[model samples]
Target chain A: MAKSNKPIVWSLFAGGGMIAAFVLPAMIFITGLAVPMGLLLENALAYDRMLALVGNPIGKLVLFGVIFLSLWHAAHRLRMTLHDLGIRSGRVAMLACYGVAGLASIAAAVVLLSI
Target chain B: MGEVMDRRPYVREMPKSWWLGQRRYTFYMVRELTCLFIGAYALVILVGLFRLSQGPVAYGAFVDALQGPFAIAFHLLALVFALFHTVTWFGLTPKAMPLRLGEKTVPGTAIIVAHYAVWFVVSATLLLVARA
Candidate 1:
């Protein structure tokens, strides 16, 4: 029998799920609601502060992990969700879902590095 | 051998709309659909990051765009979906990784509580640190 690559995808899915569960709510609340609505400091996400955050090596790593893993996790889940919705073309679904995620991950890496 | 050959196994076909018939199934679908919002929110952040890399003006424009009515609405919905994902994920943690303490399995409730505790601490830290 051929080796299955399910584990690799599943690991990323699980890790991403963990991050999404533990950290994403606060992130969304902060960036989406609080900052935009003036609930937090006036310049919580100002360009200079944000640039500084992304400029730091540790910040870059953290942002990369969150963006990369979350994308993979969502990709895998979306693939399954598509299947559940009766799109039975497995190969096509897999390619489309994972393809977007792969491209986005590369984009994230590049953008982070350039910063 | 002849009788065995004549017997066909029964196979039940699941209707595509099966999930719609039950509340639990619908909830499950909603839970799965959280990925859409999560994926979208990730892309939004990615765009913001890209803009930040471009320059201050570009990043400032991106931030300005986020405050518009449509952007605010999208984020509001995304926030709801994200919170839903968090709640469901924490609920399933115990089943995914049961704790065993020297052959005695820890109660699932305890495991769930621990997850919530960690989640709260992490969230508070992020909010506070980001605010500073």
Candidate 2:
């Protein structure tokens, strides 16, 4: 309810919406493609031909974006999880929950940018 | 130096709000806990991606790690949690984000049924594609 808690709450809402919108659809897309591609990639990599497929600009961008948003969403949800599990309580606990989520999102963002 | 101290609050009473709030409060807590697996499973996928991005060897190692007694046990646990998370989420979706048109409110059961229908379609499509 307080102003400080607003960003984290809004982030959680946005993250949830993003997961529903992006991650679920993307998952269906990727998994639908994975069966054939996984086999090809697995076999081709043995002969050093598949690296280029995974190393493309568009592929990398999509992969990194999905990973970042999905994980960020997960981090926020997991904080709620800890609270539900009775591991978090009180003001300090609330801060810790959002703090961990923020850090996790930042870490995922860094991973996306770097890789 | 002699002193006796009672750590408990001296008031001999439970707040009135506790009695009024217990049922809803407990239900809310359980609902939140049940929904947690959605996040947990997502984290597992994230870890898999991290490993995959590391390189072929790391990816292979991650795959290999999934094959064993512990992996089997955890996978089952994950499946159970995932199912619980999905069902509860679908159950609550209508309440959380109601779809209304003028005077008509969509039923929660309808939302849940639609969710399962979509999940089944998506899952089957993937399976079919995999076999193809």
Candidate 3:
């Protein structure tokens, strides 16, 4: 069998896509709409409470995972999508798309850690 | 020379707006665009993390901005895009792995149902965690 590292990254993209599909919509609804729209109380996201949430090690891990995986998923997906659009430059598209994901993953880590 | 070149079967390259013409092609384009929404969504969360690290003052403002009309509108649009992403992704899962059950291949409908079931569980977990 000819082994390829592509599987590893593809696995990440698949997992990330699953996580994003399952979790992100609700998260957006709650934080972006429900809480903000006053369907939920204001202090539902009070500064201290949110700080405490991010302060938790588990919380940090989940946040970081969500950010990292989702970005990588989008990066790989966009790379393939460009090909579908006949970009005709796989190497450059791969580098550009994955490069942003790599940098953003680092940034997400740094920010999550600092919190 | 011109006549000879013109005589050759001209392969028309796909137009940039080629997706707009067909329902299937438009859906494909929408699916691709949803990837960007997911990317943008991740950026939004990362920004929240950065703001939190900066301290309560910055984080408060981020939450404030999220409440604002523009942010709400963006998220509302994002919600639609995210749902599109979810459905399309799960729809393809069976093809991606083609799961088997004993001697029989698992049905794609079963795969999608399993995905939704797990999805509900995770969503419940997140809700519980938030409440806790």
Candidate 4:
């Protein structure tokens, strides 16, 4: 039997799920609601501060990991969801789902590096 | 063996709306659906990152766009979904990874409470840092 690549994708999916579960709520609340609604400092996400955050190596790594893993996690979940919804074209679904995640991960890496 | 091979096995057909048949099934579907919001929110952050790299003007515009009515509504919905994911994920963690304390296995409730405590600390730290 050929080796299955399931473990690699599953690891990414699980890691992403872990990150999404733990930090995503607070991250969303902070960036989406609090900052925009003036619940945080008026300049909480000001350009300078944000630039400084992204400029730091550790910050870049964290952002990259969060974005990368979360995308993969969503991609895998969506693929399974599509199957549950009766879209049984497994190969096509796998390509479309993982393809999007792959491209987005590259985009995130490129953007982070440029910053 | 040949006679046995000639016989076809019966297969059960699942209805299209199977998930809707049970409350737990429906909840499970909703839980799965949260990924859409999570994926979307991540993409939004990705876009913001790209804009930030573009410079202050671009980043400011991105931030401005986030405050619009549609953006606000989406974020509000995403926030709720994210919270749901967090709750459900924490609840499942005990089952996913049972902790061992030497000779005895730790109680599931203890594991869940520990997760919540860590989540609280992490969220508080993020808020403080962002506001600082």
DockQ: which candidate is best? Answer: 1
DockQ computed for model 1 against the true two-chain complex using alpha carbons? 0.85
**Cα error, candidate 1, residue A37 (Å):** 1.2
Which consecutive 10 residues in model 1 chain A have the weakest lDDT in total? Answer: A35-44
lDDT of 1 by residue, A1-115 (tens): 9999899999999999999888888888888888888885567898889988999999999999999998999999999999999999999999999999999999999999999
Q: Model 1 clash pairs?
A: none
TM-score ranking, best first:
1, 4, 3, 2
Better of 2 and 3 by DockQ: 3
Candidate 3 residue B92 Cα shift, in angstroms, is 1.6
Model 1 per-residue lDDT at B6? 69
lDDT per residue (tens digit) for residues B46-120 in model 1: 999999999988988988888898988989999899989998998998999999999899999999899899999
Off by over 4 Å in 3: A1-4, A89-92, B1-10
Candidate rank order under DockQ: 1, 4, 3, 2
- Please report, as a residue range, the 10-residue window in candidate 2 chain B with the lowest summed lDDT: B33-42
Q: How does candidate 4 fare on TM-score?
A: 0.94
Report the Cα interface RMSD of each model, rounded to 1 decimal. Answer: 0.8, 6.6, 1.7, 0.8
Global local distance difference test of model 4: 0.91
Residue runs of model 2 more than 4 Å from their true location after superposition: A1-92, A112-115, B1-30, B34-36, B128-132
lDDT of 3: 0.85
| Candidate with the larger TM-score of 1 and 3 | 1
